[model samples]
Target: MSSEAASGMDVDGGAGRGGLTTAERTTIAAAVNAVLVHCQMASNDANFKAAIRARRKLLALPTTAQCLDVAAISDAVLEVCYAMGCGGFPWATPRWWVKRRTGGTWEDLRQCDDATDDYFKEKLRMSPRVFREIQETLSPLLQRRVTFYRVPLQPDHIIAYALYRWATGETYDSGTCSFGIVRASGITMVHDVTAALLTACPDKISWPTGLQKAVVLRAFADKGFPNCHGCIDCTHIYIDKPANANGEDYCDRRRRFSVQAQVVVDMNLRVLDVFVGYPGSVHDMRMLNLSSLWVRAESGQLFTGPPVMLPFGVRTNGYLLGDNGYPQSEWIVVPYGGLAQHPTKARFDNKQKTTRGAVERAFGRLKGMWRLFLRTHKCNMDSLPQQFVAVCILHNILIDAGVPFDDNLLWEVGPDGVRRRVDLGMHQPLRPVCMESSTGDALILRDALAERMIAQ
Candidate 1:
């Protein structure tokens, strides 16, 4: 742009009294027009016609209007500058991307906040307190700095959008309508929220240690399982068939497309460990062996605490409880499973069932709270695992906050939230399963633990 053209829009939309002079207008017009004419925009560009009309309007503005508004004059000239730099006209912001400008989604979301706590639980799968805690916790990582063009969504709002979507399992299209956002922005909101949660999740979930390990051990001992650290279980997260060659592997005993998650939960139902991303067809024991937990355990890195002496001279440092889905190990105790169950073993199985109910109850509550696990997932296979882990972290967070679970929530939550499809372009081949039940120290530990339990 020429000095004359730049000077015409001087002082931030302020101009001298009276309209621009005929000669000054002529200079500005010629300079701006020269630039606009020479700039090449694609012939098939959506804004091509709008650009032509903008040019004609620029050419027609009366340079000699003595009473012209300075603001109008500035806008007129800058509009062309806008067109030259940006492919669209200055006013041509994409309609769908900018839907929440005024009395739209943001206001509606605010209005949905009634004084009671029920609204947040139903809408976000959590109470207001949990929501705020998460908002404050994720703010540092999720909050984006304001750019000249747009102010980012608040951490609170992003978390709400993502949580509500997960809790309700609504499709993104309908979710956009509910939230007053366009599909693209809604999708970005989920991504931003998921990323922040994942980054913070590792710290939220882990095996019991220090003071926590003591509390967990005492809690389980009181429940009739001595030296028990926690319980482990597996559940399936249903999904739509993948749009890939190996999509069939995700199908399981239910013959549904899904993935498996191996969760180890403490007595209080907080998720201590998570291993997900396997096809739903994989056996439970196979999933465990493939996990980092298994690697840590097999390397003698896990259960390093001092041993607890049991009946019959048996001892275990600490052990996890599981159902027959997993064979017994020195570090894990599973029940006897033959036609003629011994009275000692039968009595122990009853206790095992009761204690291991924590894992089953944990899965029930997890799926109940996060409707994501209730229905077939619509996200990428790779994305589903991270999102599952993220929600699990939230599960532990809510538990720590003393948020009570209402069994009725499962019946009350509405249809699934709309999910926009994501393709991370990754694949998993079915991993093979099983080692014969160990007759060694694992059998001795089980027998000792069972005998110890029946005696109690």
Candidate 2:
């Protein structure tokens, strides 16, 4: 029984109860003081024993002639004993306290006003409407993956918890409190939501092909980067040093352990493809070569159309804009490194840098909206890649929903003409391989494009 009930203090009663005579109140006050004094002088173990004896003695006190109420005196003495750390009262657990603190009202949070909605967007990285739409879209898959017979979690609550953790970069324990869930359940929800996004959203994040490729090229042409299909770059997602023997492989040039992710983004800042799970130590160029997108492009399967025609009667396949770290190819254009030697080369480099900023801006928007990528995730190394890809998918979804970019967070080029934010250490330029005819043709096309830009 609860201490209040055992002591005959009505558990539902407020601070005020039936009035006690002055003499009865004085007697109860004396008993409480004596209990406190004994507890203060005793060790924890001794005090617990004394409290038990005191409780029994107080409960057996007579309540007839002297108006000595056993119930009131017992309640007073137990309160003193618990305060002194003798530990007879039933205190609320941490989960119970959290529930009380948050009032378990997640639905109310979803229906907040504009100011509160903005705050939620800042905290959760998406507006309530977007979050709800995603939840509804992925509910079927998530329901199959995550189920509880008792205390079933709402799909929106699970997705919200995951987004909150990603947006705020908070630990699961702290993140769950806002959603009225325990830490273990929060972790499960994050995993399930991430899996659901991966399964449900890949169709929305396709590589540009056919008419899509034409549309993408037109967008690039409008930006003064004709024949460009997308911008390619790589960033590292920091992670805990793996506990396994191969941990050293994950350490990057900055001496921080991480997983590398390569992204291909369109002018709209939507991710076309993401290749994750490479070690941070791997060079960006190497990761690119290893990606499926590269394999498909190399096989002439990524973009299908008539070749793009440039000045001087030069024609070539659509190419992606990349930094010097990537080797120049018929399908990948890189800026000339000797820009200082010629005004034409300098102009070409400037245009290339400006165009390639799409990928940098995409990365900036991604890491800015979901700050989890900005810090080390305390998850198993094998599972981290899936989570990273899931964030990229979510990023594309938000862009599709017309979420405006925070222009203040856009990436800027440094004085050295490189993106200033070093998400991963700068990659050394890849050495030119013996040119296949296609690669030689790509170099020729790059020079032709530079000449074309100069003449313009």
The numbered model that scores best in TM-score is 1
The estimated TM-scores of all candidates read 0.74, 0.71
Each model's lDDT: 0.73, 0.73
So what's the TM-score on candidate 1?
0.74
| Candidate 2 ranges beyond 4 A from true positions | 1-108, 112-115, 144-149, 407-438
Residue 366 lDDT (model 2)? 89
218-279 per-residue lDDT for model 2 (tens digits) = 99887667877899888888888888738789898778888888889999888998899889
Model 2 weakest 10-residue run by lDDT: 88-97
Instruction: For each candidate in turn, give its C-alpha RMSD to the true structure in angstroms.
Output: 9.5, 12.2
TM-score of 2: 0.71
